[model samples]
Target: MSSRISTTRVHEAGIETLQKRQVELAGAQERLTSGKRVAKASDDPAAAARAERALAGEMRAQTSERAVEASRTAMSLSETAMGDVVELLQQAREAMVAAGNASYTDNERRGLAEKLTSIRQQLLSVANRTDGAGSFLFGGQGAGSAPFVDAAGGVQYRGIAGERRTEPATDLPLTINGDGVFMTSLTGNGVFQTSAAAGVTQAWIDNGQVSDPSALTGSTYTLQFSIAAGATTYAVLENGLPTAVTAAPYVSGRDITVDGQTFRISGAPASGDQFTVQPSTATLSVFDTLDRAIGQLGTPSRTAAQIAQGNTDALRDLDQSMSQLQGARAAAGEMLVRIDSETGRLADQKLANQSERSRAEDLDMTDAISKFQNLQTGYDAALKSYSMVQRLSLFQYLNT
Candidate 1:
């Protein structure tokens, strides 16, 4: 226990032991106060770095969870909107068929016309559907307003040609074209049209005629049937001339003239009752087709074949229009489905990422508590040894 600079083993050993005790106490206090073993980098640089990384990952995951939920919600809203479009298209198709019925009274036909008009309005509404945030469903990136507008205040599409998509997951993209604009082609004039009555048939004029001939106007041809004779004979005349042709093409509905009386058979034409165009101009509109079909219903003047044929053609056109609309609806449905699937998949990915990040950054309370306890015990032991050794210093007992 002798004291000297280099030779005093007791003093050096005791001093070293006291320093060690102080370090132990510092460590214990830090673990108890902070509830962490590696508070600083120097404490255990490697462990601190790993734990810090894990904790950072947890924070990032928590933050991203909100965004993931938002994406899922957006996709869900888009799908719901698309469902409405399908319903509207179905209604429109039904109205078109009702207008085409041959047995319908004029009043009934007019009612059907009104219903057809309503379908157009509904179609516009479907095109204009918006999300909760007031963004248009089919407006592409510019969701500022309704996607459908109209000429004469009727329904027309105003949306962008392209589609909008959402990114909910990596390598998977979801689309929300709930407005159905993507599949439907332009729907006016050239799209849904009736031929001009005054001019010669386009096919005839195409054969190098100098000028298109004016069509006969305002004629009703009577078709008589004698079941006893088993004969269905219909008389035809163009300006009172029997311009009989074996086959007549009626791209547009026929112009009927019978016994100096004139009635225009204007509607979708049937196969056997096609006639030359009348001098009257061709009427075509979203409303035109339905109005004409309604007007022709239950007209006793027109022949049975003519009536039946007109209605059949009208129905067929309606079916064609529905076909087009259904295409758009189908496309919308496909996109909605794809979007929902991608959104769900993306949600799963986000959840996984969140879990990984949390694992990376979260603190293990149990492990931390155990470490702090061990540090406390070691500190207490070091204090006890320090007290015993420090009290026995060479001059301390003599002074006491």
Candidate 2:
């Protein structure tokens, strides 16, 4: 009577296994259908984290790409503008050479002057160039205004201070500065100052009753000097290589009462030997050695001595201008080459970033699909087994 039968707990533990399989199958199917591995953090926490990092990296790569692109644009503009300047300078040099030849007639010179004026205007245009795309090639960051403007016939830069960043890449960290620093007259002192060149030669010139023309006398040719408006002191090759004259310690302006005659020097006097007051000294618009050459090229029907003076000084100033222009051109060419090299490096970096991002976040379709099919098979088996076990009641047992 106390006989006991071995009884099973009627447990559906297989259901649990089935449920887990179902979850896996659903996830795999989702990945296969949508072509996405980590749609949400709940799907796979580890994958979610990895995806986030990849996404952030991609965004950063894009930012770097944009930055490099901007730098490229700036370099292109800078190169073009500089090229124009070079061509203009070359034309100017040619005109100057023609001026050097004695055969250049007045009519020919007038034509050359017109050509020179056009070139000068073109040069000014080049200097005042702008990207006009909310930036300036010659200017740096924080640009609030145009990079360059004309101030009293000279160029003035009013843009923000910035440095052109080197192409952002994994290679060498280099930079390009487009501040027009090389030949920029305002930034530093070259041979002379940019202010109008007019000064009094207080040193003694020995000539006539004043002193012997070729004597080392301490007597400075004391003459009152005052420069008229729109005039500059181009040449001051004093009798001897006297020291620089300043008006600070002594009276700077020409207001000294020399003897009884108050002879005022409007501009710097040529020499005591040849003294005749003229209205204009030389160039009124420009005040450099080039401008001096223009003054010397005039075939004036005036005095023979005046014509000789013009011819003599013109050639000397042209030589000086050539040296200045050549130096500036060389510097610009060097900078352009640097920018081009930097650009290549930046492009390489962008490509590398793309590869890295793809590796971290891309899905593998073949592997995902195979895993999904296996999970589906396991779930089907569990469901069928659960149904079969449930139907094994006493009624069904009797029939069996």
Candidate 3:
């Protein structure tokens, strides 16, 4: 049996074929002009979704990079401020050393004190330095104004005792703790402090050393002197309780070891004179240390022994302050290193995100142009075929 086809059906099928060809050609042209394989979600749902995710990731990476830059800038400024603080402290130390010269008269000592005072002011300024954005470098968490305030007692840190951080995937610190760097330094030799009793004009004590670390009780001790029949003797008392060294022969400039602590008492100590030793505490301030040294230097009628004692104590405290500030500066340097590492990581992430998005939606131009030409040729052939089929009427065929 043979199948019969209607003329209406033939014409309709031919027209539909041409319309489909035109639609494909238009799609190819759109891809070529836009340079995107997936211009809309309806074009390629999966590819479009992937591209959207990659774009979001790329934007996040960019935001994080910006945050890293801000962190780097703030940390660098903070580190520089800390360095300036160290330098100023060194200058103050030099002036303190010069003040200790025995040959320098009272007026000369006063001049040195003035230099230290100026240095203190400079240090305060450094402590309150801003990050060029109205934010303090050592402001800790945050501050509406200056962090360090010079009051009647001494320099005080008004900021909170912590650090601010940048907002991003990479957590980074933006400030340093001002209290730890400026206010909370260990007193004396960072172990024990030695001092002569008040009003004991004849005796002066040196900064004590730890003779035996294991034997230290961290207790307060006193060395009391007594003279009997022209024979000077001293006793050791631990926490106000007499030890076994009662009435021991007293020798000036001799090492006195009590409870594993060693120090020297120079010059003749009158009967009833006493010296005290206590554990070192973190109650010293950099500014307060300088202030005490300045006060001692400016005071007149001080004995040679008193001057020597003052110098010894001041130098010890200054060394402690320097150590503390250096530690803080070192921390800032470490943070900078971290920022560099984070920057590199973020750069790599951004590149990966860009590549992912390109792969998901970007067109391969060479393949795209070739495909477009093929579609154009197919559409032209379809147009020619449609024109020929439409002209194939029965009357025309019969005449031929």
Best lDDT among the predictions, by candidate number: 3
Q: Cα lDDT of model 3 overall? A: 0.88
- After superposition, candidate 3 runs with Cα above 4 Å error: 1-11, 394-400
Q: Which TM-score value belongs to model 2?
A: 0.59
lDDT tens string, model 3, 1-400? 9998888888898899889988998988888899899999998899999999999999998999888898899889888888998998888888878877889999999898898888988988888989888999888898889999988888788899898887847889878888888888888788898888876776678887889998899998888999999999999898999889899997888998877888888888889988899999988899899999999988998988788888888888899999999998898899899999999998999999999999999899999999889988988998898788889998999999
**What's each prediction's clash count?**
11, 15, 0
TM-score of each: 0.55, 0.59, 0.92
| Runs of candidate 2 exceeding 4 Å displacement | 1-17, 34-51, 105-107, 132-134, 140-145, 160-361
lDDT of 1 by residue, 31-67 (tens): 6666555667786777667766655654554544444
Q: Per-residue CA lDDT of candidate 2, range 1-400, in tens?
A: 6965432444346566667878888778877887776577886677667667766666665666566556556556666676666566567667766754566667676677677767766766665566667555556554556555656645455655446454444221112233333223221011111111132122221111212233323223222222335232322223333324322122223442222212222323432222221111222222233444454454444233333333333333333333444454465456556546645654565466555545544568888877787888878887888777767778889999
Scored against the true structure, residue 55 in model 3 reaches a CA lDDT of 96
Give each model's whole-structure lDDT.
0.47, 0.48, 0.88
Ten contiguous residues with the weakest lDDT in model 2:
187-196
Candidates sorted on TM-score, descending: 3, 2, 1
